[model samples]
Target: DSLVKQIDAEIEKYFSGENPYRFTQESRELYKSIGGTPFLDGDYTVFGEVVEGLDVLDRIAGLPTDSHDRPMQNVVILSTKLKRK
Candidate 1:
């Protein structure tokens, strides 16, 4: 989370500049309704969604990480199944 905070600080510093990209109303509403790293709005690209096993996501998020932010335990993805509706 420290890295996220550091990135937030840098984003704040840049937000003072002219023509800074602001978070969209959709993103703002989503953040308010749920919760998220609003600072990452336009920063990262989400490739996929966890359709199930949210508990697994919570467990993974709670795991201890090293200085490089890599989880201490080796969490491997053996395979993935993508379904469309």
Candidate 2:
């Protein structure tokens, strides 16, 4: 979807638009190239980032999902740790 349509969707679902403080053209481009859900830009809380787990992420993403988009088997998160710079 075009950027305008994505913003329109956010407004339609949440009755408000993207957070002006957080939304930007660069972010929009990142979302587009990364297969992200742009409509979630401001409405969702970011849980965490996979600083060192691209292969694991890819493996999980490759898992088969059910009709509702849940993984067919339970995928337990083994652990999480903050990676300090």
Candidate 3:
């Protein structure tokens, strides 16, 4: 939840700035108008990077990207199991 808290703090900062209207629902509407897609990209301690099936992710990333660079289809993770270290 740290990431969520971080993003919330940033949103609050934006709302408190001089251009207060920038934080309105219309701002989100403007993003939708431009077809914006937000995503997280990075390594986090709580959820480590995939140790296997990385090639699959690469393939997915290589697929023809949309205007927002997201793959056309959704990729589902069937299951995951933790192994003894």
Candidate 4:
């Protein structure tokens, strides 16, 4: 199935100096302050980071959701791309 084919197991790092891309000190500190799960460092996969539009993310995350956590309103993916140096 195409959906099954799209599934992949890839490791992603959430900390600086570990992944191909680095998160800012501010972000790292924010993660710590927010009590992010650093304990699951190597367990699951992260895949990518959001370099911008975090404000939008916060707004969406703050929206009321159902028991399953799906937003009551629709959210759409407009575009996405990997960062390149």
Candidate 5:
């Protein structure tokens, strides 16, 4: 029982934090104009942002969807190649 209690305490600590919303300063600004969800700020893993093709993403989001929000028509990705600066 003591060992189980220790493990539970650690688990709780891992999920606990002072702020429910967390983001970089740049991200915080983006939250205003572009947008963001403060409620889910720290709950997700943000790898990268779409620096390009934002218009395409907007178009896809505007596509028609069903009751479940799945697009009624399949949106095909033509290509994705990384451009080195």
Candidate 6:
């Protein structure tokens, strides 16, 4: 989809040094240490964030994570659906 392509393009820009927020060595190392895998595995997509559940998202993001940035407990999405705007 177009959205997915856009996300991939943005990621490529950051990784290829075309974006101002390019990944740094320290960041990469930290990510690896925290067990954060590269975003290539499709765990996330362009249209994944939920506007109404942002508080929950913030809490999850704040959780204690391992060296690879994976949280100690698994956070699963039970389901997702779009609401009429």
Best by TM-score: 2
- The global Cα lDDT (0 to 1) of model 1 is 0.80
TM-score for all predictions?
0.46, 0.52, 0.40, 0.44, 0.43, 0.43
lDDT per prediction? Answer: 0.80, 0.77, 0.66, 0.71, 0.80, 0.75
Candidate 4, residues 1-85, lDDT tens digits: the string is 6665444322323222355435699968988797565546557787777899899899999999997678999999898778975
lDDT tens readout by residue for model 6, 4-77: 99999887886785635357899878877876546543465454446787888899999999976799999998
lDDT of 3: 0.66
Ranking by lDDT: 1, 5, 2, 6, 4, 3
The C-alpha stretches of model 1 lying farther than 4 A from their native spots are 1-32, 67-69
**Candidates sorted on TM-score, descending:** 2, 1, 4, 5, 6, 3
Per-residue lDDT over 1-85 for candidate 1, one digit per residue giving the tens place of the 0 to 100 score: 9999999987787765644546789967988898876556668987788899889889988999997578998998788889886
Clashes of each: 0, 0, 0, 0, 0, 7
lDDT of 3 at 57: 80
Clash tally for model 4: 0
Q: Which of candidates 1 and 3 is the stronger one according to lDDT?
A: 1
Give candidate 6 misplaced runs (Cα > 4 Å): 1-45
Which portions of model 3 show Cα errors greater than 4 Å? 1-46
Residue 84 of model 4: what lDDT? 75
Cα TM-score of candidate 1: 0.46
